[model samples]
Target: MITNMRKPTFIVKQSLKIFCLLTGFAVMTWSFSFTKYIRGQFVNLNVLPERLKEYMYFMGRRLNGAYLSSLNKADNHDIPIIFIITPTYYRLVQKAELTRMANTLRLVKQLHWIIVEDFEVINLKTQEFFQSTGVSFTYFAQSKRSETNNHHRGADQRNAALDWIMVNHNPSMPAVIYFADDDNAYSLEIFQQMRYTKKLSMWPVGLSGGRTYETPILKDGKVIKFLAWKAEKRKFPIDMAGFALNANVLWTYKPMRFSTDADPGMLETKLLERCCTWAEIEPLADNCTKILVWHTRTEKPKVRMFDNVLEV
Candidate 1:
């Protein structure tokens, strides 16, 4: 019985070896053909069918860690850094809104979040919350000019963030600047597109200016005009979330800062005019047809009920 079992085990081992050897030989043969094709050699293309080429490409991407190692890499000096400026104010759902935003921003590559709170001081609780989220961030406080003023109070905080950037980041460094509001919902694709902004990049914004979406009218990869509800009234009728700037633009055009003194709902236009003209705006998101960001607002949560029940 022992002799019979040994014979079967040995046969099985030999069979496995033969199978592996045949698979290796087939892969090597195909790899040689693929290499030749890659080098522009028009060899017998029948060796690599469409389906086999697709399979090998997919497997090659996986094995080479293209999708697995997107954020952290051994060498990424060529990648441009993205500076995201978020102006936040205390609210019933402030923490919840920030937590949701951070979850999305964490997936972005080469990002630095600059969150400026509209408060007199940066509270310890908020500091601890930002740290716990694990998103690389710089938290600071800049009090609103008036306690009761509701006319774009975030303008001051945004300017503060811009000042911080100007002082901290070098103008020679390759970087992109985006004003990402905490209440807005963002798609990671926008980050990818904005990373390559040479001067000014604009895309569509969903649910902006009392419309389904607002975008720049592109003609031959250039912005001809804006397709917004208030396009006629405002010089640059793009939403704050719809545009991004190359860091060098801000460095060179030092006057490009947000101001509450601008006409109502014209803060975006005010800052944009100092940076670029309509012709200079580069239309992104497939020529401004796709919306990669949305002006979403979270409802005020009823946390007062939790006051008498349990700590929330």
Candidate 2:
């Protein structure tokens, strides 16, 4: 019995040896020192089993650390940092949205999250979640605003974010300001598109309304008409995700605030009133040919009214 078991054990040892040899050969072809590479990887050999925690260095560090490390190695010195201002209200899906957004933002280089809460005190849970993202972020708490109803407070929350940026940043800093709501589905290209906004850049927003998309009709590279049929009379009748402004635009227009009493969908229109003119609006995403953004709504989960979810 012992002799029979020896043959199988020997075969297993040979297989591991062959795997190590192949790995070493690949490393050598990549212009790495085979011995040194093996030494470093030896710490992780335990993941294959028959070894213990002392040999699990590869599993010791989180996988994202290696991903972030690679991002740092890329030539990104001049990529303008984007300040994502998200106005979020506390809700059942707030944390879920932020976590999902963080996963998206992690792939974006040189970005910061400025989350403004719609309540008085900073939510500790939200703050901790932001810190855990492994990205730069700032959390602020502001008073709620409601025009017709108490829940119509996103406009006020947005204004507070702008106010925070104005107070913290220099007027001439090289940054692009984007009002990114927590619940929207953003494409990675949105960051790349907004990085070079000289003044205010506008794009077509997908999944808006019940049609294909809402956009600014461009004629010879200028905004002629905002393409919306229902609410034809609003001033700047566009989605909040439809535009981005340069940092200088905010500095030039001091005390930029959203109107609480403005029409339900007039926040974007009213805010841009003091900011960008038609001539200054830069049409992007192939002059509104491609749709790269959507107002993705996450369906709220069903739970008991008095259920203490936090305790779970």
Candidate 3:
């Protein structure tokens, strides 16, 4: 009886050990699978820091002469174009402003201008100005501004321009697009510095009057962070005029449009949230260490109007 009892006890002990081992193995396998799933989710979301690191690694590895040579040929055949989207209202004061922008473009090569009027039709002076420049341009009017509930005409007009570009242009064409307000000052070197933009390019704008006059956070010739009061809550903080976008990214994410409903300082956050994070934005114009553009607001000119006479 004693021998038989010992034999049964040993068998039970061995069985328990085997069960624990099997359970441990299953738990480890499940943990590994869960980790992989989380990583996949991050990639799909295009979260800034991780995505930017991955892109940099890819660019570094592919930066060889053979790769560059092939890319050069391909780029020549399908050259990356630039489109400057400017939204304007019917203010007659903008004539000088538009002329300044036009003169700046003369220093930039191979750029397309998308000038949208926040009115029912383009006025004669605006039409004549564009025609006289002989620069590549597309003119359109968002006539429904007065009828719409939206008051942020700038954001709406920019979105319209983006929609127009996606609808009319080839998706594969290399292009860089930027929103240039009518009165802002642009530097010549800004365009040259943004030439090799892969995803998004950024530069510093002067006189923003935040913690930093410029928002570019640079370490080792790369943009690591953006310090802006506007995007303090968001993952990255940047001004609308501070960055440029690649056309492919825009086309790939077609319906990603700007929101006029975003509260005063939230427009940049809302737009960036739809696509990439701070990490995915590439730095250009030498990490914006040198001031290239100024975020100068138009000074309200003092003028006197008496019956039929106007004095400035």
Best by lDDT: 1
Candidate 1 per-residue lDDT over residues 185-277, each given as its tens digit: 999899999999989999999999899999888778877777897799998898889999998977688777886777788898889888788
State how far residue 223 of model 3 sits from its true place (Å): 3.6
lDDT of each: 0.77, 0.71, 0.67
Q: What is the C-alpha RMSD of each candidate to the true structure, in Å?
A: 22.5, 19.0, 23.8
Candidate 3: Cα lDDT at 1:
94
TM of each candidate vs. truth: 0.72, 0.70, 0.69
**Model 1, which residues run further than 4 Å from truth?**
1-75, 146-150, 303-312
Candidate 3, residue 236: CA error in Å?
3.3
- The number of residue pairs in model 2 that clash at the backbone is 0
Between candidates 1 and 2, the lDDT winner: 1
lDDT of 2: 0.71
Q: Give candidate 2 regions above 4 Å deviation.
A: 1-77, 145-151, 229-231, 305-312
